[model samples]
Target: MTTQISGPRGLPLSGNLLAFRKDPLSFLTRAASEYGDVAHIRMGPSRHAYLISNPEYIKEILVAKQAHFKKAKGLQVAKLVVGEGILTNEGKDHLRQRRLMQPAFHRDRIAGYGDIMVEEAVNHIEAWKDGELLDIHHEMMRLTLAIITRTMFGANVSSNADEIGHAIEVGLQYISKKATSVLDIPLEVPTKGNRDFQQASELLDKTIYAIIEDRRNEPEGAEHTDLLAMLLAARDEEDGTGMSDKQVRDEVMTIFVAGHETTANTLSWTWYLLSQHPEVEARFHQELDEVLEGREPTVDDIPSLPYVNQIVQESMRLYPAAWMINREVVENVEIGGYHFKPGEILMMSQFVMHRDPRFYDEPDRFKPERFDGGELLKRNPQFAYFPFGGGPRICIGNNFALMESALLLATIGQRFRISRGENEPAAIPEPVVTLRPKNGMKMTIHKR
Candidate 1:
């Protein structure tokens, strides 16, 4: 017999809706702390959700019984912007797309893109002058966007970066509003929000389609080496046919949005954390100085730069860009001695789990060394620290994102030390499509 699940007795009708809307992190943290590993939450009058933080239960839901659940309804919002790409697709379609895109992110292929990552970071710092205050979040957004554009299409999108970035922001805001909305409004409705969403969607679609069309029209044997080219060239072994134009567009839009946004958020939070922890920052610089020796980092240097990787790893643990993940139960399942019925939702948060004192000695402290020598992994081998998630459906760009962040961190750290600018409001992560720095991250740069 399964034990009864207990959770907060939120307001009637709305249940935990208001609390969640008001402050997601606080509510979830309290739920995990007060209710233990398995908490049953009622988000709405009719909605039933479960919050699980124990790594063992997490493994059960995400790995052992993954097929018994589908992506949560919140991701339905993503479908509006990215269509049927891997992030939002289900089951067979997802598997097929993953297979096709696998080669692009293969270790060997991503290794080739390392130079581009380093070059882009170097070029970004060249435009900076000492004592200039800038929103580092915006800078990271622009930098990662540029790197993805060049590496994905081999096209210099510096000229269109601002326009594309704005479009992404608009789309992100629309999707976030949709995900959090109590009522599901039809997109066809001509409300101001709907109109703005349509305009932004059209702009993004136009931009991506233009790239796809341009690449399609390129001469045969054109020096096509980017991800777009790889997708276009990929053929199904069973059918011997490549993805259709619409399919290609869906994927490009998917990567265009997801590929850079998460990494930018991670790097932004990383800088914020490093700024607050001078000792960690000092150690980070020491590692870069010794390993890089005033030279640009190559792909081969990634393994040698253990601290660089650890800093990013620890940053991810603290403020995971993909902070919360959800899944919808497709069948009755039992987890953590509780019975879950079909159609129920399961929500897991990296923010909550990463800070659990049970796993880390000083969970709230910025200690990158905890990740050194695989100490954290040894401490908890379950699903305790899944910033990129686990299972077969893990983020395809996990390796790519890590490499880009480490290289950028090393390259940038070598030249400048960033300090939080005066009068800049404290950075708070607003849980949107991704955990975005609320008002962007403002910081001052000092040349080393």
Candidate 2:
């Protein structure tokens, strides 16, 4: 006899879609808490979705038996924004792209980008005035966007930062909407959403293609250390052929979208968390002061400042940028002793699992000490703490993001502190393609 999967009941036609759309974070978290390890949810009349909260089962889906699944519907819709880039690619194509791009993200190469990250963080905040109220989320977004463009693409987009940021925002919002909508509206339908998405896509293409063309027109053998240059020159060891312009564009777009948005959100959330927790913030400051001795933090300083890393880890646990990862069954597979058919969706939420009290002491509280000496991770299952997704599809820029976040925190924390206003309400987490602080994170900036 097969075990029955139970979940929250839903409306006949729309199923749980309405509940999910209303408050995805709360809904998913509640489902996992109430329904045990695996909760069945109906997205539409025909679409079946399962919320997988058990770490072992999550490991099976994302790592062990990952071959049985493909990128879920959200990512499929993301192809409109990223093309056939690694984020949306599967099978052999995904492997080939990963192989080709692996060298650029190697530890040595990533270490070289640290100085750029610090320099950008410094330059980006040079104009901040003490006591000035600012939307720190927007500030971090601009800073990270500048860093990614310079460090990876070797392009200067500071002049068009707002335009590029707006375009990216439009693309993400469109993907988030389409991913959940019951209607499979074609882009050619000329609906308002479709038209806005098309415009955003065009702007991104123009910006990326312009960058590619500029690199191609550089003097023959002109040396460039950026990821774009590497991609232009790389050849498959087996095929001895370089990527086409479109292939390069797709990868760049993926990096441009995935790379900066996530780190910016992380930094934004870190600052917010620090502001809310004074004791943790004080300890964070003490660590930076003792380690850096009033100097700027470098990649080398990261190892010495364990507390800085802990703060970031704790922040991600509270506000993971990529809150949920979804996978669609491509082949029938049995997981956690339950059989799932092809086309069914598996949902794994970092937000939900990260806060599960079963694996955490005071899971809702922001306690950086929980990760002291990385003992908590050892005591728990691997999937219990995956801010970055697991297995082969884990974030390619995980190291880069971690280094950037810590360095930025140490660097900026030494110079300034952002505090929420006494009258200001807490920032709410908006569940879009990324978990962003809705209405932006507005706080007063103070010199340390």
Candidate 3:
């Protein structure tokens, strides 16, 4: 027999839409705390949503019984920005794209980009003066953007970094708003929101397409080490065909948007958390000092700097970049003894699960040692601490993101320490498409 799921009550017309919109992090956290594992929430008059917090059930939806569900409405709306690339593509096409692009992110291939990562970090911090007050969030965004543009597309976007960053921000805001709004306004209508979204889309297209065109013009035998070169040369084993320029553009756009935004947020939050936790920050700095010996971190040096990785792990536990995962049921399925029908949405939040007292002790505190020796993972359920998610469709850039975060943290930590000002208010977690620091993370940069 299926279980009867219960959740917080809502108004008749919009159900929990208003509450969810007001403060999603707090709302979801409360729902999970009060309603148990499977909380049924009515998003709209016709839409049924369930917040699944159980690790076993989450595994069922994302992995064990994943075929029964598909990417939910938010990603469907994301098609407006990312197109039908890997992030939004479904089933066979998605698998095929993954297969083709897998080589570029392989351990060996991405390892080669470590030099570029450190070099970019070094170049980025060269202009940072002692006692400078700046938005570290924006600084990280700019740095990661430069790194991705050079490492992935083999182009330098330093000149247009601000424009590209603004365009991406516009796209993320538009997607976040439209994904939850009850009213479905078509983009064809020339409303201000739609117009801004379209303008952002065009700007992204112009930037990505230009890169694709340049690579296409390269000599046939010219060797290149970037991701774009790999995509252009990738041929399917069965059909032996390559991706067209349009297809390439879709994939590049997906990476260009997703690639930097997530890691930047991770770094920003790490800085904030370190600023708030001095002991943790001291240990983290000690690790960088001992491991790298005042030199920039390399991919190989990562294994020796376990504390740096741990600090990142704990930061992600607190404020995950991809905070929530949504899946829409495509067929009848049963999870945690609750029957789910087609069209119902399942909301799984890394933010909530990572902080659940059942899975973690002193859940809200910043303690990197919890992950020491990887024993906590063995003690808890699989989905209890998924920062990059699990299952087949997990973030493809997981390794890449981890490496970049470690390298950047170590590289930056070696040279400077970021601290929050006494007068500045706490940085608010803005849970947009990705969790970003609202109004930016303003901090004082002290040279070490």
Candidate 1 C-alpha error for residue 433, in Å: 1.4
Worst 10 residues of 1 by lDDT: 1-10
lDDT of 1: 0.89
lDDT order, best first, reads 2, 3, 1
In model 2, the runs with Cα more than 4 Å from the true position are none
Residue 50 local lDDT, model 3: 94
Against the hidden true structure, what lDDT does model 3 obtain?
0.93
What lDDT does the true structure give each of the candidates? 0.89, 0.94, 0.93
lDDT of 2 by residue, 225-321 (tens): 9999999998898888889999999999999998999999999999998999999999999998899999988999999999999999999999999
Alpha-carbon shift of residue 399 in model 2 (angstroms): 0.4
Q: How does model 3 score by TM-score? A: 0.99
Least well predicted 10-residue stretch by lDDT in candidate 2 = 1-10
Which parts of model 1 are misplaced by more than 4 Å?
A: 1-3
